[model samples]
Target: MKIFRMKNCLLGSAFLLLLLLQFSCKSTYELGRKRAHGISDNRLYNQIVDSSLSYKSLWVKRFSAHYESNGKSQNVKGSIKILKDSIIMVQINAPTGILEVARIYITPDSVKIIDRLKKEYLTSDFFFLSEKLNMNVDFYTLQSILTNSIFQLRDLYERQRPFIRNFKGKAIGDKYVFLSDKAAKVERKLRKDKYSRLYRFNYQRFEIDPSLMKITDVIVREFGEEREMVLKYRDFVKLEEQKFPSELVFKVKDSIQSLSCKLKYNKLEIDEDLKFPFKVSNKFKRIYPD
Candidate 1:
C-alpha cells in the first residue's frame, strides 16, 4: 500500500524515464568544440528550425531502457504512442510474458495511470502533479522531451511560431548553445500558474549539435530550487531523412527526491494513425497522492 502511494504512481506518470542514469556532466557540457564555417545566428537558427522532425503522429513500436535509483538498477521494456499536441500513451511491460506492468494515458489537461502490480489507478491533472513535484510542468513539456524538440519558456512548446528563435544562439566551440530569456541575461516577464503556484520559466538552457542541428540537451531549474532537470538526447537514427533519437537519458531532482534513466528506442514510425487503449479493471482500486 505504501509503495503504490508515491513512487510507482509517479513512474506511471512518465517518470518511466527516471529509470537509468548512465549520465556524465562532462559529456553534457564539453562537446563540439571544433570550429565550423562562420554563419549568422539567424542563418544558424533557421537551419536548426527548418531541420526539426516534422510529424503529425509518432509510434514507438517497442523500447528498451535501464533505470536506477537508490543504488538499485533494473532493465525494462515498453511502448509509447503520441498524437501531436493531443495525447500520449505509455505501457511498461513485465520482464517475462511481456505483460503490462503499467499503462498511462496523458492528455493536454490530465493524466491517468493504471498500475497492474498494485492493481490501483490514479486520476489527476497537471496542476496537481505540478504541485506534487514542485516544478513548472505541463503536457507540452513532456511531449517535447519525448520527441527531442525545442520549446520556449514563455509560450511553452514551439508550434508554428518557432518560440526558440527568440533565444540567443551561437556556436560555442563545437556545440550551439541556446539560453532562455533569463539564461541569456535578458529580462523577461515570467508568469505564475494559478494551480501549481510556481512561477514559469526558471533558468533554462539548451545545447545543440552543430552537425545535426538538433537540440541534444535541455536543462531547467526553478526559481529557488538547487537541483535541475537535465535531459540529453543522442544516437540519432534517420527515418525518411528525418532524424530521431535512438537513445534518450535524463535526470531530474528536487529537494527530497530524484530520478534518472537511460532509454533506447527499438522501433519507430512517424505520421501514423494510432489508437490508445486504457481500461481499469474492477479489481483495481483508485488511489490518491499522500
Candidate 2:
C-alpha cells in the first residue's frame, strides 16, 4: 500500500512540473512580444532610420567583388555607380582578367542585363525581378541593397513623404534594435478541412549601435508559397565616417532548387569617375523563363 501511494505521489509531481514548464514558456514568449511596446522615444528611432538612409554617396562608389553561386564559384571584379534616384549601373568582370562578363543597368522603370559569356541580353520591367525574388524589387531596392543602405516600401526617389513611421524598437543590454512592422499574413486551405497560414516577413531589419549611430547588421527576408529569399550583411567598414559592409551573403530556396551567393569586397573606392559600358552582340541568345 505504501509503494502504491508513493508511485501516485511521483506521478502527481511530474504532472505539476510539466505545468510549470508550460507556464514558463508562455511567459517568456509574452515578454518578448512586449519588449518593444514600451519604446516611447520617437526621436531616437528616427535618428536610427535616418542614419541608414543618409548614406547616399555624393559622387560615385566602386568595389572589386568575389562572387560565388550554385555550386560554382568565380573570382570576379564588380563596380556600383548610383546617381541618386536616377540610375544605378553594376558591372562584373571575367576571371580572364581583361574580359567583361556581365553588366546591369537599373533605372526607375526598367532593368537590363547584358551577358557576354552567353552573348545574350535581358530587358524587363521591375515586375520580372519582383516575381523572380518573390518580393518587391525596384530600382531603389537594388541600390539600397547593393550600397548597404536603408530601404522602404517605395523608392526614396519616388516618394516625398516618409514611410518608416511604424518601426518597433527596444534596448537590450548595450544595443538598440529596430524591426519593421509585421506584414499581413495569408491563409489558405491546404486539405479539405485543414487550413494553413503564412506570414509576410519584414523586407529588412536594422540593428544599430546607439552611441556610434552605426548599423551592425541588416537582415532582409521575404516568404512566398514555397520559396523564400534571405540576405544578411556583416563585417562593416568605416568609410568617410559612414559604415558599409565588406561581406554579403544571399540565399534563395524554392521547391525545385536552392541558390546562394557570397560577395566579398577586395577594393572599395569612393568618388571616382567610373565608366558604365555594356554592349551585347546580335549573335548571342537571350534567356527567358520556360
Which structure among the candidates has the greatest lDDT? 1
lDDT of every predicted structure (CA atoms): 0.65, 0.48
Candidate 2 residue pairs in clash (backbone atoms < 3 Å): none
Tens digit of per-residue lDDT, candidate 2, span 1-290: 11111122221221111100000011111112222223454765556556663433323223333333344444444445556676666655545545555666667897676766556667777675455444466766666666655555442123334545645566775556666555222212323423234333334456655554545555544443355555555555555555555555666566665555555544445555555555667786666532
Where does candidate 1 stray beyond 4 Å? 1-14, 18-34, 37-41, 128-134, 155-166, 184-201
Give RMSD to native, each candidate: 6.8, 18.5
Question: lDDT tens string, model 1, 1-290?
Answer: 33245354336234654222111121222235455556676787678768777888878777777776655667777778888899888787777627888877888898788878778998888665555444566777666666666765453423334544556666677787777544543233333333233344356788888777878888776644555778887766666567656667777787677767777765577788798888889998988765
Model 1 lDDT on a 0 to 1 scale: 0.65
- Write down the TM-score of every candidate: 0.78, 0.65
Candidate 2, residue 111: the lDDT equals 63
